[model samples]
Target chain A: MTAHPDQTKAGAGRIVISVDAMGGDHGAATVVAGIAHSAKKNPDIGFILHGRRDELERLVAKRRHLADCTEIRDAPDVVSMDDKPSHVMRHGKGTSMWSALESVRNGEATVCVSCGNTGALMMMSVLRLRRLPGIYRPAIAVMWPSRNPQGFNVLLDGGADIRADAKDLMQYALMGTSYARNGFGVARPRIGLLNVGTEEHKGRAELREAHDLIAANAQTSDFEFVGFVEGRDLPGDTCDVIVTDGFTGNVALKTGEGTATMIAERLRDAFAYSPLSRLASVLAYTSLQRLKKRIDPRRVNGGVFLGLNGTVVKSHGAADPTGVSAAVKLAFQLAQSGFSQKLAARVASAALPPQDASSDDDGGTS
Target chain B: MTAHPDQTKAGAGRIVISVDAMGGDHGAATVVAGIAHSAKKNPDIGFILHGRRDELERLVAKRRHLADCTEIRDAPDVVSMDDKPSHVMRHGKGTSMWSALESVRNGEATVCVSCGNTGALMMMSVLRLRRLPGIYRPAIAVMWPSRNPQGFNVLLDGGADIRADAKDLMQYALMGTSYARNGFGVARPRIGLLNVGTEEHKGRAELREAHDLIAANAQTSDFEFVGFVEGRDLPGDTCDVIVTDGFTGNVALKTGEGTATMIAERLRDAFAYSPLSRLASVLAYTSLQRLKKRIDPRRVNGGVFLGLNGTVVKSHGAADPTGVSAAVKLAFQLAQSGFSQKLAARVASAALPPQDASSDDDGGTS
Candidate 1:
């Protein structure tokens, strides 16, 4: 892949990543391990593991192979997942999550990755790194587990903001499309607004307006607009990108995660029951092994917080070493593709024409 | 179990079930097979399968052993899952789904079960069966797939109503509790409100108010009032009953279903990959069978629509014979339990105090 002329002039084979070593269930050990794994494979990548020096030192000591690849930046405090976003923003200075985000703000790092409190990460990113000019809100983008070999569907605003208007939804579409092109390498991503139905008048009034905005946009029109998709279509690869409010998106993401865990648990329970069935399971062992590899959560780890000024990927809190490694890989690819810059540019260019915008102005209508 | 006073007066073992024979993915065949399966085990249960004459006749011929236990009632159309709820309500008079619901209203059956359009089922039941006096809206109750041997948690309003106030949420708690005690035979079911957090002010304003209502109520407070639960807790047996709005509940349910299907597909893919992993699967065969049985959707098919005037159960649209059979059994248990009457009494008695009436009067003060 060729680097953009503008980016090529800025740097050569240089990509800095800031990882929140204090974040996630597995803590700094997994993050350090992941960093070591990625560094060995990609020598061009450099990393700053932000956390308490003593804790990170202990973990790094256990993994001597990662010694030369990583540098530790001291962050005294660690943010808990249960803490409120507002509280975190006000009081979380010097914490690993905040400090890591700050690394990106100062250009010390090109990207930030964490498996900590998502709300806190977003809050700190917005407060410190700030939003890209002309962008209203940052959207949390997630890949919906799909049936296709090409992998999953990308959903935006998975849980960033509570309520969004038509313009915000349109912005999500543009940002998501850009990310799909850069990150997933989809030439022309099919975007779908999540709604109760496909009819123009189906959902709440905001949806109807958003539908019109998407349909009328010349910039977005270049990509496939598949109208609307239902909740069931999420895992079926019906569209490359799905967009919705944070409330719905959060619930959908949690529901998907919970369901996956439940099924795995259930499958385990089913195979443990009887001797004959156990024998049958043995006969079908090859098929079962194939199934486990396909559905493993470790294969899909990091979810990008799209529409931000810089790259910020959120790994699952429960992610293990394998999952953490995948997250590092994902972050590296996203950084290399310059996904953040591309998304910002696409959304800015997609702004409605001033004259056409005034024709249906509702600035004071609500 | 002893028969209720009213049921005894009517006749012991005379509960009639109206089944939507032409509904579901397998059409009349699975319905007939389910009826036959239930009839062989339950002498007290009787069926009235509603569908076109010829199709019903052919199905009945295949289940001739159940000749004494089952009978058919003619109906013309079948409501498709994709049909709008309002459209079906306006034009579903002669349809199998509508006719089955009507049988319960006409006293030809004590309970109704259909594997058709869920929205239409709720609409027709509300329109024909009507709500119990003073009950605002009917709730669709479900047995959550719990981790314990205590069976499942009861979740109410599983996509029946879009918006629910604090009062409606309280009623959902009451109805869900009653269903758990009477239907599932749990002495004191633990009730929980689904929320993002356990704190009092965590969720939307309505949920905060609802939490107070549940805690303050004398009747509802008698049941175990575990504060709040997240999506992950649903399958972990954290609470016996969970309450939420229809939109969130519906999305969660569909998301869970989709995830399960995706995992199954993924597991198949995993097993087909290589030899060593296949050998590992063979060694773990017994555990796999146990897992499958525990998570089998067929074993947990019947989902009850609570807060209605009478017993109404919904079978999965894609359910086969085993799933439909489980639904039939659930319908019978619900009818025998007199859960609706108990819920009505509890809710009515809980509202007798005038102090409860003044709580909402100060709404504008906030």
Candidate 2:
């Protein structure tokens, strides 16, 4: 095999990330711009851009650096943000989202990044790539901006599917821990089961049983169990990964995002309230920018779907180029570390023999 | 009955609120100071202070307004924050929390306010006052600061009990609507069932059934059902009352509080980053204060326990005088509106025939 001079210098393998340049609220131009941003920052990254060939070509033509590192796959159709997952499974034959996942499934790319409908993306990914062996359900794990030494926490089952039994939660803990290790390079991630209270006797029956299961398996799983944690701990430094049913995790994720947005609006309104305050804002502009940088949602943009046979990162549908780049960057990192293979091996080694398997009826609905 | 000059001028009846003065983190001094603050603002308010007489007397000594409006009732025991609700129930006869609830039960006070252990307070309230007719479960409703014209939204069951079924969620909707209408004067309050997504087909089976029940009863129940709402809507104007099971409500509440605290600390740090920024802070101090006051949890301190025979407001255990005063003020307003009776009437009128009453296994556990 002939090795490129660039690859030899870094001595790291080249990573080809599949990009679905369609269905984002901002459209394909923004996604192409994001590819440009990633290519400018990391020379080792390559992309197989999935969208209408002519349009992608025009957009990539503007960025010569990105064009050199990009491969355009002619997917004639686009998945609308409002497209139903089931409908997409039947009709999304030549859509960018479909082609994007196909690349990962066919070994052309190690990771797929899409700023598309999350439900549709998950559905197509599952149909094409399948669930990892012994994995009951796949969960969308996202990085929560936190006060931890690593500056983030991993929260999963972020609305991949709403229902989880005691066993599914255990899987989430293992999957989340694996993601934290491969994606963030955290050694022996601390896992916390999200509950209403930190006490043992609190929350539902399933949560209690799941707590015991996680604690019992933590050592063998190569992670530390921090027991039950409340929603407040999502952004705290006490744990690296918070595992919960998708219903709660999704609500908490949206709640946190909404809250951050609300505060940002309020702060802006405060600064713009009076002429004197506006003048003060000018003086403190740099400090305010630093604060914004610290809490920027765009910096932690990707929601990586774990417990699946292949890696797929779901960028926010409304993401700008910066947000898309953040998602692409995460995909690159995970792809480089061979996250999919490591995750499969972890699940195969640590997962219990599907005890109480019948309890997962509620999980398969959606 | 002869009316006092203070009561006759307002043409409104005087309200006597029972206070559990012993269990708060700041003790009787803070409770007395809160009463003083409330009494100074509203002439028609009175209090029945429950605690050690000598301790209460010393704290009330400096507050002339509180002294005139207060009636002391000696209760020797106190319910510590860590005390289990069941333990408190078995041996809490002389505790201030017990006495406070008893005052409401015996018709000596219109409302009860306690800054004690929440689980203990909930247990005592259920034990002494009992659930209202046709109500299967009682819930704790809190005021979340929002962008609504009312400036706040109502959220419940904020840790009253963790488990809720379909019928219980329907009852929460009716009860929360009643609270919003009577307590906040929101005419025909819009109710939203809290879920992972606003889609009709999302969430657990219970939530979906509850959505249908709420929608079906909206016209007859005298409130608008806004369908399912996400956690972001808790702080948004789209809904007035967000109804959910206690587990989700409690987690969302704490998560919002934690996020707000994190942002506030970051904002402070930003302002203190440099000398020039410190000077800018001085200039923007007033605007910042306004912003702070707008989102101050203390300003909306009380968590009103609904669907009970009597009104019970649980203040934060660590509440300072300002926070305590806010809870007291809420209790007084609720008392004046005859909110307890109104809620009981609403529950009695709107509740279904308790079709799935057997599902409430943990309803009375606390």
Candidate 3:
């Protein structure tokens, strides 16, 4: 691998990441720009960029540094944000999202990144790479900005599939812990079961059943089971990982994001309210920026699919170049640590056999 | 009702609000102070204060005007915050919470307020007041500060029960709509079922069934069915009422609250970072206060238990004088509008007959 003048060192190891260049809200150009940003910062990263060949070529050629490190695979079709997961499964061939995941499945790339349809990506991912052996479900784990020493917490099943049983939650606990350990380098991370209250008797019946299952495996799973945690604990310093079904996790994630956005906007409107406030904002610019950086969603952009045979990082669909690059950075780090294999091994070693298997039916559907 | 010199007018009919003064975290003095604040603001409001008579008298005596308008009902026992609902139900006859509810259950008080154990209060409420006819599951609806013209949205069941089926969701729709129309005067309010996504096929099977159930009843129910709404829409102007099972609603509510708290703390840290920013803080004080007031949870501080025979407003256990007064105001407005009776009528006339009654359980538990 040739190092650009901007690069400092490359002795670690070359890591190639598959990129879906066309599926993002922004076109291939913005994705290429993100690749350029990543390339400029690191000397050991390569990309298997998937999109329309001519368009990707034009975009990559503009960023002269990215051209040598990037490979363009011609998958002309784009999987739109509105595409259904089932519909995409049947007609999703030759799309950028499909091509990118294929690279990871076919051993052309260790990790893949896409700012595309989350549901469709999950569908295609399960189809291409399949689940890790003995895994009951595959979940997407995202890094949440928190007051923890690591500055983030891992929250899983961020809408991968809406349903999870007591057994599924136990797997999330294991998978989320694995993600925290490998993705964030948290040694023996603390795991929490998300509930309305932290009490043993609170929440739905399955949550109570899952709580016992997760706690029973804490010693063997090699992580601290913090028991039940409420929604407020998501950003608190108490726990390193929060595990819940996809529906609740997804709602909590969006609720947190929406609240943050509303607060930020309210703050902006406050600073812009009067001439005096405007002057204050100018004087407090760097401090405000410091706070923004502390809570910024872009700083933690990727939702990595865990329990799959290969790793795939789903960036926000409307992500800018900076957001895309943040996701790429996460992808590179996970690939470097061989997160997928370690996560699979963790699940296989610690997971309990599925109980009854009939499931508490009213649990997810009620 | 006797008009204190501090009060301005007494032309409107008298409103008697039953208050469980002893159960709040700060004790009866804070409850008295909150009552005093409310009493000072209006002349037509009366309170049936439940607690140890001696203790209540001492606090009410401090606010001389409150002594004239408040009636003390000695219940001696207090329901501690940690007491389980089942335990409370078995041995709660003499508690202040029970006495307060009794006042509302009887014809003495138009509405009730309490800051006790939520589960205990919920259990006692269903036991004492009973469910309104035709209503299967009782819910707690709280007003959320939002981008709507009304400046708020109604969300339920704020943890009244952890489980709600499709029919319960439909009842919540009508009940939430009734709450909106009576409490906030949002005519022909838009009702939305909270889900992971707004897509027709997204979320759990129960949610889809709920979507159809809710949508089918909207025209007859006199509210616009906005279909499925994501967590972001909880605070958006896209809807005035968001309906979901107890678990999701509670989690989303707390998640939003936690996010707001996190952001506010970060903003404070930002302003206190440096000497220049400290000066900027002084200059921006009023605007900052304005922004703070806009998002403050205390400003919208009551969770109203709906679909019950009588209205019960649960104030935050830690609420100060302002928070208590806000809740008192809601109870008063609800009483004035005959909200409970109107809600009963709405549910009886518009609610779909309980379908199957056997639920899809996997949802909330999952």
Which residue pairs does candidate 2 place in steric collision? Answer: none
**For candidate 1, lDDT tens digit of each residue in B21-128?**
876877788888888898888878777788998878877777656766566778989887678787987899989988898777777777889988677788888787
In model 3 chain A, which range of ten residues has the least summed lDDT?
Answer: A2-11
lDDT of 1 by residue, A230-302 (tens): 6666787778888888777777777677667777766756665666556656666666655665566666767
Q: Candidate 3 lDDT, tens digit per residue, A242-301? A: 999989999998878877877788889999999999999999999999999889777788
Q: Is candidate 1 or candidate 2 better by TM-score?
A: 2
Off by over 4 Å in 2: A1-14, A25-30, A54-65, A79-84, A348-366, B1-14, B24-44, B52-58, B62-65, B317-320, B348-366
TM-score of each: 0.86, 0.89, 0.90
Please write out the lDDT profile of model 3 over residues B166-205, one tens digit for every residue: 9889889988888888777888999989998777888899
Per-residue error (Å), model 1, residue A146: 1.7
Q: Stretches of candidate 3 above 4 Å error?
A: A1-14, A26-30, A348-366, B1-14, B25-30, B348-366
What are the TM values for chain B, all candidates? 0.86, 0.91, 0.90
Tell me the tens digit of each residue's lDDT in model 2 across A1-366: 111113321224557888999999999999998879999999988888999999998999898888777888999999987777888989999899999998788777788999998888888887788777667778999998888889889999888888899878988988988888876789989999999777676678999999998998888789999999988888888899999988888888777777777778888999999998999999899999998887877888889999777899999887999999999999888877777888888776664655633433443333
What's the TM-score, to 2 decimals, of chain B in model 3? Answer: 0.90
